[model samples]
Each structure stands twice: as structure tokens, then as C-alpha cells.
Target: MALAGVRVVELAGLAPVPFCGMILADFGAKVIRVDRTKVTMAMDTQARGKRSLALNLKTPEGVSVLRKLCVQSDVVLEPYRKGVMEKLGLGPEELLKENPRLIYARLTGYGQSGSYAAAAGHDINYLAMSGLLSMLGRRGEKPYAPLNLVADFAGGGLTCALGVVMALLERSQSGRGQVIDTSMVEGAAYVGSFMWKSRSIGMWNNPRGENMLDSGAPFYDTYQTSDRKYMAVGAIEPQFYSQLLHGLGLDDADLPSQMSFSDWPKLRQVFTDCFATKTQAEWRAVFDGTDACVTPVLSLEEVSSHPHNQQRESFLQDSQGEESPRPAPVLSRTPAQPCQGRDPFIGEHTRAVLEEYGYQPQDIDRMLSTGVLECNAAKARL
Candidate 1:
């Protein structure tokens, strides 16, 4: 495991922080998720590979406990509007004084200091600020957010994790850790760097959705099949486009040049009518394993059983028999491990986690008796 012996204190929030914690846990870090005292069932897939400790941070005792945890932790993930942690006395300035090796990773929408830093926003808002939203979706339609994937997960969570890893590498030589102020807005723009840089060149010449990769090109978009399902096409090269035409039983000689932007609508309609003549499965038979770059638009429930995914174990059944995606970026050796068991109920590991952190039995019992801690069992139907 790459992150073996790393201990992460994840102050639980929504999407981004949990996802960051999950990635560290996947790589063998021991992640303890600090949840609110009152919590419901675990519906989050990102909750995997974590132990939960429900503590009311609004209380002095809970904040003290968290401070102690940070003093002993390798990484502390904070996902809040700016100033919340500082108000709680758990900010990096205080914690890093105690634990010089602490990687205080802050994941936020705006950042530590900015015009919108104190304002509230969600994934869509962050993406919009990043300027990534303006180029998304179809040509004439309003900019459609891609369900929070770009900002929340890819930009915020994934970028924060990468920063934490790089900080760890730097700390090995410096013998000191640093704070990572990861703003989702900046991260989203960085993640979309390719598109941004390409736009200035010839790649993205037209307006939104009128470009080659943005569903503007008839050969690179999705088409509905006879079964009402869809297939995605990305036959950009001359060779692959030839394969796409051949798969559709069309001759290249009769069609417009592959790059004719003016004729794209005509080409799209022709491909649409042709795709509608066959089931998605039939088209899969024609294009699968070929260089056409055509693949069925599989549903959530359908992906686990797909031949390629199954062979690679891209999706695996967890301890509760629920199918979840496996950890990605496979390593030749010491590959990341999937979450082992059913996710913990809120506060399920409160007592156990406290004991692991060197709290005595009496201390644990006192915290449990007070309003400081909560220990629970059984899953809620949240």
C-alpha cells in the first residue's frame, strides 16, 4: 500500500472532502471521518475505507479532541467555508505549531481568501466561476452542468489528494508539512487546462457545442439506437472515421469530408437515421473491438457485467454485496485496495477510534456519557 502508516483526520462534509479521504484510504491510509453527532445512514459511496467518529464540534470537548487528533495525524482534511476552522481553533496555524508534519489540506469552493471566499456555493457555482461551465453542453442549449463531477470530484477532491501526496513527498526531505489551500474554482480550471489551452489554437474555433469534441462533430457524438439506448462515437482520425462509416454500412466516397463543419448537421442526421435502424447491441457487434471508438452508453446497473469491465474487475461487490467501482490507476505492484466491508454507520467506531488514539477506558466512558461523543450501531435508512 502506498499510503501505509499515514493517518488522516477527515472532517466530514459533502462530496469533495469525503472523496479526498476515500482516495487516501484506498491507498492504505487509515482515515478517520469526523462526522456530526447526529447523522443518518451512509448513502455515500465516498464513505468507504473510513471509520466514523461522531463528535459535536460545536462543543468545546469535541474541538479539543479534534485538535489532539490533528496533533497526532499525518493529514487533516477540512472542507468548510473559509474561517470556520479558524473560528473553531482548529486551523492550520494552531495545529501545525503542534504537529509540524501535519498536512493541513483545505478543500473549498472559492479559497482561503478571495471575493467569493466567504460566500456560499456548491459544485455548479464553483464550475461556473472556473469558466468551465460556459463551454459545456450542446450548441444552442444553456450550459448544462455535468452533475458536479468536474468541480466537486475531479477538481476539488482529486486535486487535493494529489497535493497531499506531493506534500508528503516534500516533507520527507524538509521534515515539515504544509497547508494545502485547494480552491475548487482554481482546480476546475486547471483540470480543464487542455480545453482552455486548446481554445486559443484551432481546436475550439466555434462557439459552445459547435466544436469537434463537444458534440458539435457528428462523428464524435452519441446517437440513439433502435432500442432507445445510445452509443458514443469518437472517430476523430481519418482511419477511425473510415471504420465508423464502414461499421454503419456507408461508403466514405458518398459522404462529405470528415472535417466539413458546414455539413455536420447533415452528417449527424444521416448517422442518426442509420443508428436508429439497429439496436444498440447490433451496433456493438459491428464496432466492438474495432478502432471505430464506438461504445454503448451503458447504464449504471449495466456496467458491472460488461465484458471488459468484468475482466478487469473495474467494479467489485463489497461486503454488503453492493457493486462499487474499484480503486483506479492500477499499479504493477502494491495496487490500491477497495473498501473492504459495509460502510460504518455514523459513530459506529467512536469508542474504538478513541481507544486507538490512546484514550483510556475511563476517558472514553466519560466522553460517551457527556454530550461530547456518540456511539451507535445498526444502519439508518437515510
Candidate 2:
């Protein structure tokens, strides 16, 4: 229980919200997720390790219950449009007044304030606004979504969680609470800082997949093998590139010139021809444990069973029989464990959670009857 005894509250939604809860729970925090009565399997997996309470925020009782939790929590995570929390009576300002030591983390697609703050957006929109879309895909193809990984997890979830931790540390000294305004767009822009600097200095081009790290450098790209499997090579240094060329037994007279960018097309042609003669496994054998900086591009199904990953126990099966991503960066002591329980169905722990929060059982029942709180859909009827 890394976050043992620390109380956190989560206003649940999509990726960032549930991912944050998972992180906190992994560290041993008592995370209470406020979920709607309806539950989905995706939500269940992400919502693991947290207690759930269903409160129809449309009702005054639901709002009341949330306000009480705010008073008692050390941190609160909300991923909504800027004013949605305020509309539900759980905005940062109001919550800070209730718990001055609380770390209020707000995650949204735009931000707390901006011309686009009120506009609807998603991961793809953020990527486009941050100039990341200009560098994706081949030169002639349209930009594909880099999945939701960039904006949702790295930009949104990780930024919010890190900000909350920083705020918590500051609060220890000042005994005060603060609002962390985390926007997916701004976070994505921060992540592209290196690209911005490179472009400013003329070392980078915005053309899609035509720059050094994209597909420009023959030594730093993916190549297909005879079996149609792919391998990635990152032999960037001169010595490493030489080693790669030497290890592959290419004749020096036939090798492409290394320093001439204009010759990259010709060199790339040579590499393509050389690599196509062998399978991925053959290349792996040639470069294994070498300075050529080469490796096979393994699929997700193959990765977990890879020798290195299996030895490191990078993936673990939980008690629920789900093979979930494991806790990372092994600590010397107080190691984090795989989450054991299924994601609680909405309000599955409503009565127990309210009791722990100091509400009497009868009072809890009254709230349920009056629609201030509800557990499952069946309770909504009576």
C-alpha cells in the first residue's frame, strides 16, 4: 500500500480519469470513484482497486455526498469540460474552501482558459493543435491518430498525476491547496518541445515522415524481412552504422556514403535490397548483443512472452484472470502488487463507503430512497 491511508477522490470518465485512479491505487491510496449507475466492461478494468459509489449528481443528495468527500480527501481528480464540475457543485474553488490541503487536479482537452477552452475536442484535435500531426505518416498520406496514447495518457493523465504530486508536496509546507490546470493540448505541446526547438534552428522539417527521426535516415527506420516481419534499427552513430554495415558483410565499395544527405535515397535502396534477402530472425541473429543497435519489431502478443520481458516480469496476471500491465520501476522495498479485485460495479460499495465516511446506515438508506444517492439500477426503482 504505497499510498496507504491517503484518501483520493475521482470524478470518473474516460482514459485519463481511470488511469489516474489506477496509479493512485497501485501506490496504496484509498481512491473512491464516483461513477454513474451504468457500468461498462472497459470502465470496470480501469476502475479496479477503487471503491465505487453511484450518486445521480442530478439530485441534490448526490451533490451533497460529493461535497462531503471533497472535505475529507487529500486530492481530487476531475476530467470534464471546464464548467462541468462547477455545474455539479464540485468545482476547484468550492472544493479548495472545504479542504485547504487538497490537491485539485483538473484535466480537460483544451484547458481552464483559452480561446478553445470551451470548444469540444479530443486526442486527435490536440495532436493537430500541437503541430504533432504535421510529422506523422508518410510524405503523401494523411496524418493518422497516434492512437490516444499521446494526448490521453502522456499529456493528460501523467501530467495531471505529476502536477498533483507536486502540489501535494507544496501543500505540506504551505498548508494550502492549489488548482492544477492540465490541458491535453498544452501538455502535448510541451512534449513536442524538442521538435519545436529543432524546427526553429532549421534542423527539423515539418513535412510528414521526411525528417531524420521519421523515415529520413536509413539507419533509424523500420525494414521488412523476407517473411514480411519488420525490424527496427537505430544505429545512429558513425561507428554504430559502420558496425551494422560491417556485421551484415556488405562490401565497402558497394556501401552508400554516410554523410551525404542527398545520397540517402540511393543508400536506402541498397539497405532495402540487402535486408530483403534475410528474414527478421536471421537479422536478429546477426545483430544480437552487437553495437549495431538493432532489434525486431515485436507485436503485443509476442512482447509479453519475449525472454527479456518474461525475465523482468513486466506483465502479470491478476486474481481476476486479466493480464494487466504491471507496476513499473521496481522499488527496492514496498513493491506495488497486481490489483486483485474486479472493477467494482457502479455503487457496488456505496453503503460501505458511506459508512467509512461517517454516515449512519439509516441516513445512507434515506439518501438512497430520496434519490440523493443510488447504488445499482434496481435501487433506482424503489
Candidate 3:
């Protein structure tokens, strides 16, 4: 309940914007998702703990309603390309003029003022352009995408949320709000700072996958077991490496020096052969409670039932009976509550929200009848 009094108006879009709103809502912020009247409401996991208001922004009445919401809200999160909001007369300049303490956060692939600002791109494209993609795959293989986690959610949503919180903190002193331009490409590069800085330290001079943490070291890679499942190894320090060798039933005197680059492939093969002697479960039992830094690579279906995950209650079933991850980075004082209901249908709370914003029942009826607003019951099914 850290953000108990915070109000966030989230313009519904794809992953990034919804993700930002989800984090806010998780921490007790009231998040209202503004969706287009014509769009169908997909069951987006990010829509948990949020209400929906469906309006046609193309209509002047709809724009007026949004402006009124901004006048009383603390933050507005948008993921449109540059100039889209300006065309609708809801740009930062106009909105901030109405409410000086409003935080206008813009999340996009590029930035608000870049050559690629208006170009359409997804997570893969942003990662490719950020130079982070070049350092991803094996030395000679094509770089494997990390599946939208890096750019779309981590870079875009998480970064924007952090910026919004920081701006809010600063506003406490300045008593003014400013526009936040968050570019996923720039955010992606920022998150890969260690990779970029490592080059000057000579630790990252080699090609991708030829470095210590990139699966170059024999002690820091995955090996296949007899049953074809894999175990991840991260015996980085000398003590952990020693534990790993002990668990593998190998004598130190018989093996090559641990840090010898020339011996990596041979040692990796040794590990591969040794792991192939048992199934993943067998090896898991072997190193069950030791600090050997080895663990089975679990499949998605196997995760919820895993002992550690079950002990920690890392995943929980939502009100709709779907398994979803719990809110993370646990807080001692203000722990987040589990979300309690299904995601709102499009315009499910449109009437209620309009009433809260001071619109009379007659006004709501006129707007609904004029094609300026919509509700789930009025929309045609696909």
C-alpha cells in the first residue's frame, strides 16, 4: 500500500504500457485503463487490479473526458508513437497546463525526439539496434532473442515505472511535474551497462559466448543429462568449483587447471559425459542440499510443483483460476496483496468512472447514445 493515494490513468496498448500500469496497481495505486470503444477486451494478465473505461478519443467529448481525468489524476501513462496524443489535443503541454503536478510518461521503441521515433518496431528490433543483441548467442551462431523480456517489459515498462516514481519523488520538493520520454532502445542499452563497461576491462574482448559469464567457462554452463533434460551450473568461485568437482566425483589432481582457457572444452566434455550418466532427477538428488551451484532446468509445467517454489508460494492462482506469478521483490512493511477478480470487460466501469469524474447520469446516457462512449453490453462480438 505504498502508493495507496496515487492515481494512474493508463492508456491501454500492448505489453509495455500495461506492464507499467500493472506494477503501479500491484503497489496499491488506483489504475484506470482507458481503452478504445471499438477494441475487444483481451484477457491481458497485465490488466489485473485495474478497471476499464472505453471511449472513442477521436470524438471531442471523449477527449474532454480524458482531460477531466487528467485534471484530477497524478500520472498518465501512454505508449503511442510521437504526435499521436498531440493530434488528439492531449499532449503534455496541454495536459500539464491543466494540472501542473501531472506526470506524463511516454513509452515507445525509440524516443520522442529521434530519427527512429516514428518507426514501428517491436522488442526484437529494439534489442538488435541496442548492441545488446550482438553479445547474446554462441560465438558463431545467430543471436537468440531473449523473448521480449529485455526490451518490451524490462526496458520499456519497468524503466518507465522507475522514472515515474523518481519524478514523483522529485515533485514532492519541486511541486511540479514533467514529461518522461522513455525509449526501449535506450533503456535496453542502459540495462546492459555491465556488458558495455566490461570491454574496457578486457573481460569482454572475446566474441560472444567466449566470455566467462556467457557460457565460455566450463563451470558456468548447462549440460545435458542421460534423460535429455539439462542442469545449469554456476560454480564461479573457487569454493563453488571445488564443491562441483566433489559432487562430480572427480579428483582435482586428475583434471587440468580450473581457469585454463585451453582446458575449457575438454572439461566441459567431461562434465557432459558425467551428467549423461544419470537422469536430471538423479543428479538433483546427488547435489540436493550442497552448494555445488547446480540445478535442474525446469520446464514451465514443472515449476509450480517444484519444492522451493511451492514453499515460497512464488506463483498463485488468480480469482479466474489461472496461475500467475506473485508480485516480486517482497516488501516487509507493505506487502502487495494478491489480485482478487477477473480483468474488467471493456467499459465495465465506464459509467462509474464518469460519475466519479463528476459527470451526471444524463451526461453519461447522452455520451453512450451519441457513439462517443461504449460499454461491453453494447459492443458486437467478434
Pairs that collide in candidate 1 are none
What are the lDDT figures for the candidates, one per model?
A: 0.91, 0.80, 0.90
Q: What is the TM-score of each candidate against the true structure?
A: 0.97, 0.92, 0.96
In candidate 3 the C-alpha lDDT for residue 299 amounts to 90
**Ten contiguous residues minimizing lDDT sum, candidate 2:** 36-45
Q: Which candidate would rank higher by lDDT, 1 or 2?
A: 1
Q: Which lDDT tens digits does candidate 2 get at residues 1-382?
A: 5567778888878887778777878877888888775454335457768877887887777788889987888988888887888887788888887788888888888899979988888899998888787777765788887799888878888878778778877887899989999998888888888887888776565467666787777888888889999989888888899888986687657765775677878888788877888999899889888999888999977888878889988887766677766876576776766467666777767888888889998999898888777666354335
In the predicted model 2, the residue pairs found to clash are 3-27, 3-28
lDDT of candidate 1 at residue 281, scale 0 to 100: 95
Q: Give the TM-score of candidate 3.
A: 0.96
The CA lDDT at 361 in model 1 is 86
Give candidate 3's total backbone clashes.
0
RMSD of 3: 2.0
* Model 3 stretches astray by more than 4 angstroms: 377-382
For residues 74-155, what per-residue lDDT tens digits would candidate 3 score against the true structure? 9999999999999989999999998999999999999999799999999999999899998888767888888899999988
* Best TM-score among the predictions, by candidate number: 1
Candidate 1 off by > 4 Å:
42-44, 377-382
